[model samples]
Target: MLLRDRVALITGGTSGIGLSTAELFLREGARVAIVGRSEDKGKRALERLEVLGEVTFHRGDVSKEEDSERIVKEVVSRYGRIDILVNAAGVFTGAPLIEMSVEDWDRTIAVNLRGTFLMTKFSLPHMGEAIVNVSSTAGVSPYPNGTAYCSAKAAVIAFSKALALELAGRGIRVNVVAPGLTDTPMLRGIAGSEERMREFASLVPLGRIATPEEVAEAILFLASPKARYVTGQVLVVDGGMTAGRVTTAGSRAAVR
Candidate 1:
């Protein structure tokens, strides 16, 4: 019961890592609320979460200021306080910089960076609690044809660090979790083919892609008392993908 009696609100909680985190939070005795744009998905997540604890669904787009403000208000009105906030709503569109239109850049930035900021802005007063932002390794490394997605994620990392410093005196901890090649619906969409997925998996040192639950576990640790003294840090959950350098000899060179 690490989070007993806590109140948590998770954006993009209808699927993937957000959904997994909501389930984990509820299992640990936290009352949870999930925000999503799809009513069906939100309802399904609510149903699943209700089995563990008091759970609610707030349908809204994270990129909208009105939606973020209204959802926070609703959660506060129902739960009295928000002990945790997970900014996990994001979008990924891959295209080279020259081909990426202003709309593509704006849309990605709006949902990933701007949405995180708006959610934090509205949830902070109610958060005498913790904030866990979901960033990505793409923010730190250059990914092919990922200008928009990379830029937004990089901005998220910076935003969380700056906000963590500003909110330190308020007893609020802010941190970012940068997951690499997680097996989420979004990732599947990007993979587009089984061959691509396999190629991507082969790049990971672990020889596999991380499940959404694995990422959720890391996030829960940061939000729990275990990380009480930790703040303004980025936790990378990649399977050593970014830790190694390219070798000319490939796998055979390791035998030497």
Candidate 2:
């Protein structure tokens, strides 16, 4: 059990990568608390997790400072201390730069970027351990009409790196896991059509999309003692998408 007796708090844990990570942590001998915005979803996740180990669910918007602070307090009050913090709560919105409104940009940044900051801020005092910030390949590569989402994710990468340096002296490690095109409910929602989803999956070098569990596995490695010396790093689990190249006529372009 790599995480034996550890306590983890995961934001946006009702579904997707967050839920999978919570489940994996519990199986590895960790107690977990998951936060979601919907009570029904939170309760369902809590019920499912309870079958594995000690699990608590808090329903709240991670973008709110009070909710973030309250969740940290609630977890510490119940679990004594927090060994891991996973800021997996995020939103994805796509629109052409010229069409994207201020509200859209603000909302995207608020939940994906600000939420991560607030959660880390509140969890730091209780976290003498590890923190994993979930980023996206969009942070490293440009996607069409993903201005707000891309910028927010890129900010997470930068924020986690800075945080890692700031907390190194305290024995606290911070790292970012940038997942590629994962087949989460969130991604499915953005698909809107089956054809669109298939097209997106076809672009991956694996000829398929990643499961939430795959991404969670990378996150677990970063959070566990196995990565004790790993900090200020961005681990990209993109199924080789960013490594693919393009050939046109007698010319070729290589991608890194």
Candidate 3:
């Protein structure tokens, strides 16, 4: 119940990591506002979240300035203040730089990078404590054929660190969580089938993609007061993929 009595606002709250975080926040006692662009998804997510605790749906496009302002205003109008803000709304496109369209690249940057800035910018005035942004392992490590995603996500990490400094004096902490291959609709759509899923899993040191809940847990920790002294940090939750390449050194014991 770390968030007991707190007010939380989650972008991309309709699915994947965002939705999981919303549910966890509710269970921990926060009144949450779930923001999404899809009306149907928002309604469905709201219905499910309502059963857990106090929740509301704020439909908007985070990449748009107007929507960002309106979303923050609506959430405040409903709940008065925001204790935790999670910018989890994101999109991905798979194509090599040479093959990628200009529109695709712009959209990726808009949603993953600009969206974060807009949300945090408008919400800063009404914030009570912290903000946890969702980046990707690709942000730290690169993703093949995913130039746009990698670039945007990497920018998110840098932007968050800079924001953390700007907001530290205000008692509002900003941090980032970079997840590796997580089991989500976004990844599933790319994998396409179970065989491809297995192929995807084979690359991870952990041998499997993480669940949305696992990523959500890291987000919760950063958003909670337990991390009060921590700020301007990026917590990488990608198992050991970014740790380094797998080695056979463990198999051979040294003569000691």
Window of ten residues with lowest summed lDDT in model 2: 247-256
In the range 124-230, model 1's lDDT, one tens digit per residue, is 88886789999999997868999889989999999999999999999899999999999999999989998999999998988899999999999998888789999
For candidate 1, which ten residues in a row score worst on lDDT?
246-255
Residue 166 lDDT (model 3): 91
Q: What is the C-alpha lDDT of each candidate?
A: 0.92, 0.91, 0.92
lDDT of 2 at 100: 92
- lDDT of residue 166 for candidate 2: 95
TM-score computed on alpha carbons, candidate 1 = 0.97
**Could you report the Cα RMSD, in angstroms, for every candidate shown?**
1.2, 2.7, 2.1
Off by over 4 Å in 3: 247-256
lDDT (Cα, tens digit) per residue for candidate 3, span 20-87: 99999999899999999999999999888999999999999999999999999998998998889999
Clashes of 3: 0
lDDT of 2 by residue, 72-121 (tens): 88888999888999999999999999999999999999999999999899
Query: What is residue 72's positional error in candidate 1, in angstroms?
Result: 0.5
